[model samples]
Target: MLLASAMTFSAGAVTPGGEAETIYYNARVMTVNDHFDITDAVAIKAGRIMAVGSHAQLQELAGNDTRQVDLQGKSLLPGFYDGHIHVGTGPRPFGATFNVPTPDQLTEILAREAAKVPAGDWLVGLMNRPHCHMQMPNRWELDAIVPDHPVMLACGVLKLTLNSKAIELAGLSKDTPEPKDGLIVRDEQGEPQGVLTMGARRYATRVIPNPALSDDSARDNLRAQLAKFLPMGVTSVNIAGVRPNELRLIQDVYQRWGDELPRATLQIFLFPGYDDVDTSLAELEGLGFRTGIGNDRLKLGAIKMSMDGAIAVPDFRTLKPYDGKVRFDERGPWENQKGDFNGVTVIPKDSLYRVASRAHELGWQLGIHTIGDGAVVEAVEVLERVLREYPREDHRHHLHHLTIRPPEETLAKIAELDLIVDTQPNYTYYNNAFMLAAVSGNRLERQNPQRSLLERGIRIAYGSDGLPHGPLLGIWAAVNRLGHDGKVYGAEEAISVEEAIRAYTRGPAYLTFDEQERGSIEVGKVADLVVLAEDPLSVDPLRLRDLAVERTIIAGQELFHGSHVEPYHQRPPTP
Candidate 1:
């Protein structure tokens, strides 16, 4: 706690002689502010920005102690923020990095890994979808390859598949009761086909080897993940899905790497009523702090709760069924819906309100994952109850997903309630990847609805829901809305590149409740910014993904130089 207090003081105080700690010049600086201002240089002192102006103006403020650098016309902008993403804090073998499109390919890979490892050892693989033959892989297909070793391969945000061995190891059987919060896709014979949706992964999670996830593991994992983010110009992230069991190790890692890595804001995940909510709240209460307690490098964020599910599964709890043909209806799992609906609500409405209301009462900002319009309305309704009781206008409780294309009433309530919509623009790019075929005619108009939300004065923030975790990809998605098949899904929803950039930078800073200290190249803000190889505004929207981060600077230090990583800024001279 003393160290945290020291960091707090050191981050904001300027040094003697008002000398800058670092000075970056000769770059096009995008000050993502109310005016969308541009500048030529910035001066940082004690890990915070001291001034922003023309190169000459900043030079006048810099002293000999300043580490001056010329960007050579590169574009400098604030760090990209991922409003929602899950980092694996458990023991996971770095199995496959590449995508496997066919089920046979997956079988071949898993079979080889199975052979190398011990028979009883769980072969946990990461980074690939449940490779399939025109559909998700089944337990039998996986069993044919490796019936001896238990194999669990997970694709982040999607579903996970298990071989027969894994199915048994997780205690899943024909008699196994399905989780109230998730679906266990089963065959006609009433047997699980091996796909575990959303919260249902608890079956596999219980069996997956955790190794107790020591603090060292958290440091190593956070270090490896930060390496990946820094290169892509991501200097801040919302550790959006920190499960109940993983919280301790993650917090310990944060205490250690808070100043050493890219800044992070943690949003603890609230399991679907099965996990003791009070126990989780007590842990936070015992932390000697609440949200926004730590220094600039780290802070506690919102409470994350899932309401609806994914768009691919069409489980977003829509008001109507997907207006399509055999696409969504062709299912193996629960199709307990009427009309054109292929959706299901994950959390009980009453429980959602209870958890959110309790969290609000406990002084935590809320970020509920609500994909469907129905979920969005319900979320706002719950927030209204909290706001009416608490009377905190700036709580800034946000709605995640809303990918189901909210209706006018939902959008109006979002604006009226002063709610932030944490969107994954990258998911919009997948418009052509899924749902378009099965989607009803008019439903496509509401997907994302960025322009509409902005018009209604709603704050829109961008996040990469780990779909490759590329901010440029997300910006491209927002600006173009072009699907993989080369057609724009929602032309009216498309926004300008500047607006998209703001959503990534300024917008997220607000959600993290640190807009005053970040989100722009402004005076007195933390110098957590990225230097791009080219101007994103001038580049072709389609070519945005080609843009590279030349350097990533956090807290007055260049933590990322070109393709290389740098050490921490050494506590900013103790102010």
Candidate 2:
């Protein structure tokens, strides 16, 4: 990063040099341009693509001082874009592997992390896998590894395993009252087990000294997490859920790095709680800047609204109950027990409409998280009402995580409204098997259905809800539509390699209103790109998850080079 800050853009425009200021030839350049074209060579100057054509054609523009890289028959593509990621702040995994930890491995990981922290501190992480519930780690098992640190390893949304310290911290003694929407499991003796489920886990999360609480700590932690994105060819992201604290993180990034920062669009938080709409709107307007603020490296983009809760929305009104055969659990006051356990709208339709309408009227793009089909329908209802009230062109507002089977009519309505979507396609590959069983039985075919989304003329962008943040895994899931068991998942809903590529690149660029500037290898666009060892489309779909990004370049500067030739980084951001 110090190396990055040392350089700055010069006064004059950059032109092609003898070696052609970094001419990449003998390569499969998937332009992902207007026609989804493929070409061999591309010449770039400053940070913009100067030409894209045959090697002989672009060689004419090379200057004596130009640097060159002979791709030697590799593949190059527009840098990947993750449309919906919580790149700013969240509970990051504890292990170095950064994937699902097995039953035995989870304990070992806690041990390793425990060795790093003081005996009294906390160590926490998720079980990353869906079936982690089947291999639940009890208090004794956790105490065996990191006994000193108050440990809480969330095995699933509703399952939590707390060490004695964490339990003590939560004040969960035998006499403690059960959390309204949650349960504290008991042992044979009626003493609290290390498990507190659903709403009960919130008690611990409330008391934990989360790293994200400190601005400097959050910034450093975010960088550690984001460092993984570059080597995977992720150049841009729509960082979801920018609350007041997250705003401070973004501002910190801008203040520290400026153009050297990774490209991102912040989806500012807009909750639908009591007077929350007015409060968020007033805060946003009071800030004196609406959406689409800032330069290329960082910009304010969408306004976020979680229409439904994840699990707590004790809240998510689904078409059916989860884990149970029917909606049999204790219901919250806000819970909608209308049809089984379909999730409930945390923000009622009236509330959502008001917030959305105000956001639209005030010039903010919306990215509402809609989990169940039931939620999607309500989102559509809100969108229809808001658009009718305050219309704008190419609004590009989107619904996030439209999971499970969406009815054809809802998909049609999304297309009719020109609404965009962002989904974690990796769910297909990693979590599909369990999700197929967990969701409403009728909607099995719509776990993600990204292909269906694209076919219906809706722009679908890919995001990783952190099973794995690698875009290659997402691409593999999009193209193969297979679960971890290697079974076809929504076979008919599988997208082509090119379409999947588009979702990771141009599709997201459009969401950020940055398509014209980048997202492709077209001449005159920013040189935000990557080089790969092989063409992603031509490779076995199963091998995609392991595909390597040899070089990652952003704005004509090499940001990440891995097991490849040393890439030049003398140039600064494009003027």
- Cα deviation of 223, candidate 1, in Å: 2.3
Candidate 1's residue-wise lDDT over 356-404, tens digit each? 7777777888898887777777778888887887777588899987776
lDDT of 2: 0.71
Residue-by-residue lDDT tens digits, candidate 2, 1-575: 11121122222434443344778889998999778888888777778777788877776767787787899899999998988777544435322223335654675677777787788977767765544623456667777777688887765555566878888888888888765334566665556767665456767778766442566766776776666677878888888876765676767766786455468888887665544667766766776677888887888888888776553223344545654232322223222224344444556677788778877988888888887777888898789788888889989999987876567898899999999988888876655433533454445555777768878888888887665577888888888877655567678888888888888998889988998887888766788998888889799887777777898888888888874321211111110
TM-scores for all predictions: 0.87, 0.81
Model 2, stretches more than 4 Å misplaced?
1-20, 88-100, 105-151, 155-160, 163-201, 210-215, 258-261, 274-278, 311-316, 322-339, 433-437, 440-442, 564-575
TM match of model 2 to true structure:
0.81
Q: Candidate 1: which pairs clash?
A: 321-340, 321-341
* Predictions in order: lDDT: 0.71, 0.71
